[model samples]
Target: MRRADEPDDRRTLERRALTEWPEQAGAQVRSVAVAGDRAEVTLTVNGHHDYWVYYRRGRVGREERVSGNGPTLGWEDPSAIGW
Candidate 1:
């Protein structure tokens, strides 16, 4: 159970290594928020905003827009979240 504000240096390094696409060159891990078996990895991919939702149960998804009824995994972009 990692806190939202925790510094995930090791994890960030690991994730950065995995992003080896040509288009993902220089992609930066902006933030990582973990809650139980869920995590939200925010990144700056090629100077563009990007994010992914990771679930412990071998499921992953990208969030282009906020939907459903609940708190965001870790994304906090107020403008993207439909209010």
Candidate 2:
């Protein structure tokens, strides 16, 4: 370490800024809709990947679709419909 009173410099500040993280973040929803008991959703996640989620009653179906692993997901599976 430096002297007890050594002040930080611009390089240190720049490095800190580069390593800093944003205060808030979330997925950008692309689309969403509902019909009867079925719902559809699309999102671009910051960390995971894009996703299309389907829900009905309390049941839900989702899969990673882009920029990550898992199958290419789209719409709701037949089994995902209804409760």
Candidate 3:
């Protein structure tokens, strides 16, 4: 019985860590929006085109583009939700 708006504890912590984009990583989050069970994020990165990321589960779910071309990496943690 998890509340819809309440992210998983571990996932929340991980997402918080991602709040600051790594200096080595070229990507920067431009916007984030959540509705029901889905989240949409827009990112802009050097050497890459602007892209949109969609999340279905929280932080542990795989991230993919709703539309556009970009490399997509799956979640490393299978048990966690939302990163």
Q: Report per-prediction Cα RMSD to one decimal.
A: 8.2, 19.2, 9.0
Pull out the clashing pairs in model 3.
Answer: 58-81, 58-82, 59-81, 59-82, 59-83, 60-81, 60-82
Go through the candidates in order and give each one's C-alpha lDDT: 0.45, 0.38, 0.49
Worst 10-residue lDDT window, candidate 2? 1-10
lDDT of 3: 0.49
Compute each candidate's TM-score over C-alphas. 0.44, 0.37, 0.43
The Cα error of candidate 1 at residue 45, in Å, is 0.5
Q: Which candidate is the best by lDDT?
A: 3
> What is the RMSD, in Å, between candidate 1 and the native fold over all Cα?
8.2
Between which residue pairs do clashes occur in model 1?
none
Per-residue CA lDDT of model 2 for 26-62, tens digit only, reads 5545545444444444455565566554444333332
lDDT, candidate 3, 1-83, per-residue tens: 22324456335423542454666767665655554455555567564657655555546653442434452343223354444
TM-score preference between candidates 1 and 3, better one:
1
Model 3 vs truth, CA RMSD: 9.0
Query: Which order, best to worst by lDDT?
Result: 3, 1, 2
Q: What is the lDDT of residue 9 in candidate 3?
A: 32
Show the colliding residue pairs in model 2.
none
